[model samples]
Target: MAIYHLHAKVISRATGRSAVAAAAYRAASRLHDLRLDRDHDFSNKSGVVHSEILLPDGAPERFLDRATLWNEVEAIEKRKDAQLAREVEFSIPREMTQAQGIALARDFVREQFVERGMVADLNVHWDIGEDGQAKPHAHVMLSTRRIEVRIGEAVHGRRDGIPHPERGGRGAYDLAPDPGPDGAERGRRSTQAHDPSADGNSGDAARHPAEALDAGEALAAAGRTARLIAAARLRHEGLGLAQDQPSIGFGAKERSWNDKDLLLTWRERWASLVNERLAELGPVRA
Candidate 1:
């Protein structure tokens, strides 16, 4: 059976990542980063089945090629820690022929990203999954910023091109103030309250943050089994972080433009495209 596997990530300098290196690795080619005055080459890289550089309908002709496109990306963004690009990794259903798979990838990227005014460098790769099964996937590198055309001239633009229907535009909010170490203190109290030794046999009352202790300690405490203790610990920490990290990672600064919904929407679009292609192909032989 085909699998649904998709992951979206940003190529940022904060994480010590380079978009040129990422593009080279995915497309199995070479790209030079003018900002770092460095040449990134992966032309000898393997497992790239297909690669393409796609742009909006009116994009400059020069960007239709990968090398020129990525080099231009490196040159335009002068910030030392600029976010170079966003990448989406998704699996292709093996039921489709290689041609169908490639077409599906190109069509998906063209519609979901390029049509939305972003340059897309898409690649189809063949590799092994953790289970050692053959994994045929697509790597889509999206421009961090969108393109705007004024009087037929293509120029770099902000994300204002894509707007939330409800919100109208991006909104600003007061930064949530830090609530101090109360969470850590609460964890220690909860640990002691249920401790077996607190009743009698439990050792000294000295309690540390649950995370500060290991799983073995819960098993030795014997009040709650290791599993329950671990579960409770997770719940406590999850609550502490719930305010900041959404379940789907929305609004994460770690991502390009801090737009969390971008990945989710792209994944859904790719899945739909894969299904549409499968339906068109009807029954395919292994």
Candidate 2:
């Protein structure tokens, strides 16, 4: 997997100078081997120096290629002088290759400019590492001219959807239900009666409150025993103590207490054991 990065910068000539000379100066300054005096004509004049060079990784070379580079520069020139736009930068996941990153960057630039009906000759460079081990990235040089019209509109209502009338309108009172004849007095009497089957058994043979509590305690003890056994096995393996034997801790015995304090303490101890086991595994990969 590779990461994608895009960076853009503006290139223009010095004050009071020709656009051609500025463009030429910028183009020549970008060459690694070429010098101002030795390889290009801008050596003595010094009229226009490559004012700003913004190179995102892998972007420079692609922008330098004559056929494609000229197109980018043309896009920049299409924008007017007064409205200078800032450079754009973005990064994407590494799944895209160097060539793919460059293509995406070019497409993104074209879409944005086309929407504004502006054309400028921009340079895009792709920076790919040696043997392609590093993530792919790109740098773009764009013109600052403003070619598109800016429009503004006032927004009133909620953007999501229309407001619900029930929630927004004036509140209404709900009417109470009316009972049939011989109703109000009968309803009051029925509400005051006690439930006979509150105990699990029938009303005549209801179990005592103490007996029910004992049964509940017995069931809880059995469940705790099972959980203790499982926890012992996990702890033994996690600690690298006994290969097959179960391990026991103070927290397991404390379960017999039924007190909230003891139960909470045991839970904390179990959580600590879980954390220790995970820490041994080290950081997760990717």
Candidate 3:
């Protein structure tokens, strides 16, 4: 039986590791970290089945080289504790052929990371498990920052763009919005307007914000209802007696995920792919 596991991590300078070393170890090749003035070599390392440096469609041709890729990352990040790279480790089902497995992995990486402007250095390995079985897996190293490739220019898509809104800066240069959610949910809306069932009573009730309030909204609504009931009961109990009252207001909308969300999202995506491939293969023979 094939297991489902996808892990994501960061290689940071705080951990006393460099991008060059991570790349060399995964690729089983040699790369020199010019910033640290040292060489990282793993050419004789074993169990490396395949390795490749993958870039977005319009990335500069020079970045095709692994050494150049990691070196650029090191050069871009100047902080002592900067994150050098993001790594994702996932299990590959032994049921699929080598070509199929590689193709699936690359497809997932390209769609999930590279398409969203990340340069991925991916490696596949075969190792012996504790039970003496062959365990095949793939490791993906990613760029920390968002990127975009233009004509002869590598654009760093910064989340914190120019013209600070809260800083009272002058020129508020408008930056392009992110291309929505990643992976399968990219460009997909939370609700569809063209649903046939939207005309029904249940669907209408479900879609209405007032009727379909979330946990926080429900809590606020319940508080308001309680206050109204308490006021009526007080008036009935004592027709002329009155006490101090407090004001109430609604809370803000729910907050979304941060850095950790991205990792979990990618992990779920990989798991989905594994299930898809298994379904395609159908039940295995005894």
Candidate 4:
């Protein structure tokens, strides 16, 4: 899967706003004034300024409809106990579908707040790319409130006969087999040679199907299945964000293929485009 990073900043000068509070005010105002169809205006109710929406366009006409964006802003403000000062950074993986990307981004903001043990209210927006492809991304404006942390104990148990003193027990004990004198075979041929019903049944008796496989053999099979599942999931997620190249085909796909090949090309093209459109942002400093 390809991975790309997206960055967005608010146009404070245009709206005569600078801080998070100002940004939130302007966003609420714009939302209230939006004339989507000359008949409908999606305005916020009194005392309810937070909003979020997803708009599919290169530069969405209305970008502050998504709630997560504002939630993030609110989160930052609360965390700092002051106005948000700069653009927030989002690490987006290219393996998500446009819609999935939007959902993931929204979820990510919530997850971030949860990880910090905070609750946030805010607005969000998603914009597409010039190619009309869903370059799903968000703009978050949030409140500035710090969230409190909650703690809990973790419990663990073992399937084997091992005990854990840390969890209020005597702890696990290991029993090692005693070696015979002069390094000779120990203890009745290990029950495999004499008893047919033993784990191996080697005394000229038919081997049980279960005994035919060793622990290593069983684990190897399971490992292969797990890898296959992981690879499939990765490929599925990556396809949503990157263009499918003809060389990467079904039934012949290889995980070793470098996603950088796709990402690098996109980066080069995007750099040129962004430089042209936002020359005032200055050259990408290193």
Candidate 5:
């Protein structure tokens, strides 16, 4: 039988939870949390069939490294009660094969979260119970902020009529990524970085100005995602532009995300995705 279960919640420091630790546990890996000066090791943990980090199209490639991604997320937030990350867990229809299950989860995440500009750390677990049945489920740790270049109002320099020495880099600035929380260790006063408006000379499309001008339909669709991110930013900052939101993945949640209706929407979406997959496999399996 197909069971629908979707759970979402914020991981807050006020509740004594750390994103690094949560990620390590879910991925069954070891990660050194730079902010806490400690290591979260779950290398021996079991039942983790797959783990992956999904970023927006224009996001930094370096963030592919799980440890680096979460550490950078931890570095960007400067609040004791800060909402570090959002987590979603849902059940996968037991009738589906492992490969089908993986694909289903990945597709849902890419469309719902990644397309919306959120970074998602996806972990799929297949646990076997004493009844000899596999209880397969997916756990997704999502970044509250959408991926984008965050520039400060204080202009520094220019390049081709663009902000060259752009402000805002307390968080994950690929030009100069912060080493620790609040960047206090490195004296993060001015985050002067490279010319984002530069051409292919930089070799990094994520930082290049041509990114917005990309001709692909996918890239063009980023405009809608951008608006969604911006709206979330305002909601995260209490109805105004927030300067502290990082260039990294840690700030500004979509206001509607907190609404109960949104959860129902997600639930419906999940069920629809699952049913579509099952139907393709036929009624017997479904």
Candidate 6:
């Protein structure tokens, strides 16, 4: 019997669930949750036939790794009760081969989700049921938020009197020495560079100018980062910020995905795909 089943749910912190854990379990791989500082090891877990991340065309390349992808989701969501992701579990026809099922799932995911600008983590599994029959399915974890990648250096201003990379490092407004933490203009580096006590703290020693350059360079290295802001937050410019690209994120949850009418439409689409694939196979050649 060919089955068509698609179920969707929100993976939210309010339910004490983690997107990182869900991704690791579905992929049967080990992943570290950067936000929770915990490790999820399911590498020995069986039944994972294929696992891959299908990022939207312009999505960050770093998210290609399952762990890094989910970790970024965790990082973007700061609230304790944030909705981390949406998990869509669908059944693959038992008549389909492993490769066929994977292909079908990937196609469905790409057309339904990726084309609409969502990052999907797809995992196909084939396990024996209690009846000793092959039960094949796939789990797709879709990011509830949208991705925005900007090209620039990260600027952390004035940590320990060190200038950030954005403070005019290339000689624009930055050609002159930057002001110190006290709002006073900085003196020449040739004079300040030798003062061990120039830092003006009780027991702290002054840092060399070159060390500040190293720190700034390190900040610059973290370029072209992605911001995962939810669509809800994007709409309300004054709402909770996901990454400041005129969008929603952590401001309010998106509701269109759970609409009864939309779900019905998705159900129909899934069934149509299954029927089309089976029809293409032509009655098993008798």
Q: List candidate 1 stretches off by more than 4 Å.
A: 128-133, 149-259, 283-286
Instruction: Give candidate 2's error at residue 34 in angstroms.
Output: 16
* Candidate 6 similarity to native, TM-score: 0.63
Return the lDDT, model 2, position 209: 28
Per-residue lDDT of 223 in model 5: 72
Off by over 4 Å in 2: 1-9, 12-93, 120-132, 146-286
Q: What are the RMSD figures for all models against the true structure?
A: 19.8, 34.6, 20.7, 25.5, 16.6, 20.4
In model 2, the number of clashes is 23
* Model 5 weakest 10-residue run by lDDT: 152-161
Instruction: Name the regions of candidate 3 deviating beyond 4 angstroms.
Output: 148-258
- Provide the overall lDDT of each model, using Cα atoms, as 2-decimal numbers: 0.59, 0.32, 0.62, 0.32, 0.68, 0.63
Error of 4 at 162 (Å): 58
Ranking by TM-score: 5, 6, 3, 1, 4, 2
Per-residue lDDT of model 6, residues 102-136, tens digit only = 99999999988888777899999998889998999
Candidate 3: worst-modelled 10 consecutive residues by lDDT = 167-176
What ranking of all candidate models by lDDT puts the best one first?
A: 5, 6, 3, 1, 2, 4
* Candidate 6 off by > 4 Å: 150-259
Candidate 2 residue lDDT tens string, 1-286: 2233322322222112223333444344332112122222443432221133333322344533433343334333222321122233344234444444445545554554323322333433333456774433332233322222111110111111221111111111111121312123221211211223432445433323245447777688567757766665566567775533322110001112212333234334433433453355454457
Instruction: Please write out the lDDT profile of model 4 over residues 1-286, one tens digit for every residue.
Output: 2334533222222223334333445244432211111111234523222244322222222223333333233332211222232233243333344444445555555544323322223343434558764443343432222221211111112111221121121111111121312122111111111123332445332334345657997688567757765665465466652222222101111112112332234335434433443344343333
User: Using alpha carbons, what is the TM-score of model 5?
Assistant: 0.65
Query: Runs in model 5 with CA error above 4 Å?
Result: 152-256
- Pull out the clashing pairs in model 1: 197-201, 197-202
- Find the 10 residues in a row with the least total lDDT in model 2: 247-256
Q: How well does candidate 3 score on lDDT at residue 220?
A: 94
Which TM-score value belongs to model 3?
0.62
